[model samples]
Target: MQATLTVSELLKRKNFEHCEVVAGKEGLERRIKWIHIVEVPKVEHLLKGEELILSTGVGWKENEEAFSSLLQQLITRNVAGLCIEIGSYTKSIPSSIINLANKHKFPLILFHQEVPFVEITQDVHTFMINAHYEILARLETYSRELQELLLATHDLSDLLSHFHQYLQETVVLRLKESTTHIFPPFQQNNSKQWSIIHKSIIDDTYTESKKISKKIQVLGKEYGELYVVVKNRRFTEENMLALDRTALAISQHFLRNLYIEEKKKRCENEWLREWIRGEVSLPNIFHKLGKIDGLHNYEGGGVFLCRKQEGVMWEGASFSYAKLLLTTLFEQCGFLLCITEYRQNILFVFVNKRQKQTWRDRFTQSLERFKKSEAYEKHAKLFSFISVGSFVDRLDEMEKSYKTAQITADICSEQVSSSETLFFHDDLHIYRILSLISDQRALHEVIFEYLNPILQYDKTYNGKLFDTLKTYLACSGSKKETAEHLFVVRQTLYHRLAKLEQLLGEDFMEPRKRMALEFMILAYEQIFIKKKEEKFPQCSEIEG
Candidate 1:
């Protein structure tokens, strides 16, 4: 039912049969909420909006400016229209007043015969009251039906269908992960047009189409958006109320699903923790997996660990959002993922659903896309490092992959400053070897025996010998390349090289010695340099 009473409709009443619109014909569609009879010159404070005002010209009959001011104020207050009695207080309507109303598209009505103000107010108020009551009753019925639908279905798409049916308009639900669900699906050829509309709405730049949107939230955080396109008519107050209720219902659905998923994840996390710790035997693992729905036929898999940056907290809604985003991204890339939280880090176990070995390329591509996404840009500060383990052939060997990924994360945490956030186990060639060595004393001795001379010389003289040698080795002993890299002239580089040879030995460039120097350089930078920077941050900053 239409909840609004427009000026055009009110003009058709028997009480207004002698009334004629003198100006602002374009505003006939203005909605009237109530009727007021005002004889005072100042009626601004008495009006809220959408009220059809009745007045006699007696208040400003002698002053045309005061009457014009009154009409201007009424227009500013957005009154539905003004009706002036033409018989008693004034014989004719002023041409200036007619022009003013026309200029602002404000409806102006003149009654040739006087009508009872009390009777008009009673008739209009009673009609509006009944309309409002009917609207409320309809809303109550809608709320009841919505509750029934919620209890009967677990799918959000089904809920969207119900919304579409009730509103009889196009509906769109867009989630945070860029997933869109649309009702009254468009034709295949119009899909592109819909995509454009969706993007415009998300960007908040759309103006060509009339639509209303509300945020759908979960746990007090915005999870998605609900949009309704206004087709051929304006939305009444009842329509807005209905949209609000729908948004709330969708939020409740999201909360319920999250609660159920979280409960299941807790159970899975415990089993995964034990399994990754190598406490479960292969036979028992197979038996437990066989009981699950889809884990019985897994071919191969790998593990990855995500560690938050220091001082960044991950709990509650933020953690849930991240988990859902990761799950959606990985599943779209053709991997079935199992996620758990352990030791303040997020762990993911992903298995290839296909028999082919193409998961690596797909995983890499997905990570690249995720890094470029808006979600990552907003939450980048929360993440510090991502360490990917080697792909294993069987589920039993997953423990080894998890351990390697953990080791990679540990290595990255202790290294000198680096902008890279993603690390691969296979790429940790020398770091893996260093991690395997149990004797820290021997490792320190190896670093000291190879690079101590240059390090001590640089510290004693405040020289650039250490940097020069490192760059020279990285340049493969190419003097020109080293000079260019250091932004130094050839003479300066030669002098530094001569000094470097003097500090160590002339035979330092031999194959065996060069290899040792290279390895020790990396180890010293990863271990000792980072510690020195931490101890004397000011000195490190000055040196850089």
Candidate 2:
């Protein structure tokens, strides 16, 4: 229904029978929301835009300049039109005023005979009031229908489709890091055009010429945008109001869904925490898995521990965002994950959903993709490392996986010079062996017995003989590779080697000695260096 009275429609009334359009006939479509009578010379401050003015020309009678100036002011004020009574305090219309009205398309109406100004105002005001009432009624109906649909279905796409049907216009919903839903879906050939338009909307560069957009916010955060395209006509204020109502409805839907999902996640996380800590019995674990769909079918699974770096404060929102990001990344690789925040680390239990033995390959691919994602790059500094445990076949064995992941994370914390942030328990060849030895004293003695002479020499002379020996042994006695790895000349490497041979025996390069030295080096790093730099001592235990 039309929301406002237009000049053309207003002229068709009985009160305007004596009125004649003298100029600006092309502006007959201008909207008129109110009617005002004015006999003043300056009406700029009296009228707002879209008000139809009724004047007797008494203020500018017999003065062409005054009439012209008054006409210019009315046009500048953006009034719908001007209706003037002739032959009363105004002899005739001015040619300059007529020309000005025509030039600016400012409607000028001449009343040949005097008509009751009160009657015209009453007629038009009544029509405007009824029009507004109809608009409110329509809006109420739409809102009620939307609320009913919201109750019937929780799908956002269904809501968009209903809005499309109501307006008979194209509707677009663009969500961040998720799919875009277009009702009455666009043609396949126009996908590229839609993408460009979506980008422009996201960049806030679009002119909004043919469409009206609103933001969909949940919990005071903007999640996406809603766009409604007006195909062939200008969008009225009523359309804007309707769009606002629709956005509110969508936001309410999102909030409802979030509340439901959060409640479910709380239950699942409680069970998962107990299961990880071995507090839940195996039978109860199986029973809980059976209760949750798509979880009982898992054939193999693992654990992931993500810890924030030292000095970075913990934020619940950041942890949630990270969990959401990882869930999205891994779910695409055929894995169902149960994530929870435990003690200073965010833990995830991933179960393979597919019936294939390629979980490892898929997990690796997912991790690599996640590292390259924009979410990771934006929040990369908030986390120190992500450690994954070895995959286990049974659901009851996840406790073992959590323990191993903790060990891997500890090893990751000690390697401060390593650029890699991702660690896997299966990949920790020597560190795994060291983690198995529970006696810290025995491990320290093994480290000292293997290379005490080189350690003492380096301590006395403040030399890098220890580092040089480690690098040399790592290079398998390849002098040229060792020199390059150490960023030193061969002469410097030879001098270090000579000093090393003097301190210990030349048998340091022997096969058995080389094995012992490599193992001892790993032991020293895991025991001494790791304990010194441990920031999350609470996370050191498996219960965490």
Clashing pairs in model 1?
none
Write down the lDDT that model 2 would get.
0.79
Best by lDDT: 1
Model 1 spans with C-alpha error above 4 angstroms = 1-255, 283-295, 308-310, 372-378, 438-446, 484-489, 510-512, 530-544
lDDT of 1 by residue, 1-544 (tens): 6656899999998689989999999999999888888888998988899999898888888578999999999999999999988876778878999999999899999988878888888888888888889989988998888888788889888788888888887788899988988887777789776866676466566555567889997533578899887645777888788889889889889877866776677687888888777788878767776664345666677899888557665667656666666666776777767788888777888876666478788888767767776656667766557888888877777899898889888787766256887888888889778777624656776676677677777778977898898899999999999999999999999899998889879988999998888888877766666466542123234335
lDDT of candidate 2 at residue 318, scale 0 to 100: 51
lDDT of each: 0.80, 0.79
How many backbone clashes can be found in candidate 1?
A: 0
Model 1, 110: alpha-carbon shift in Å?
29
Q: List clash counts for every candidate, in order.
A: 0, 0
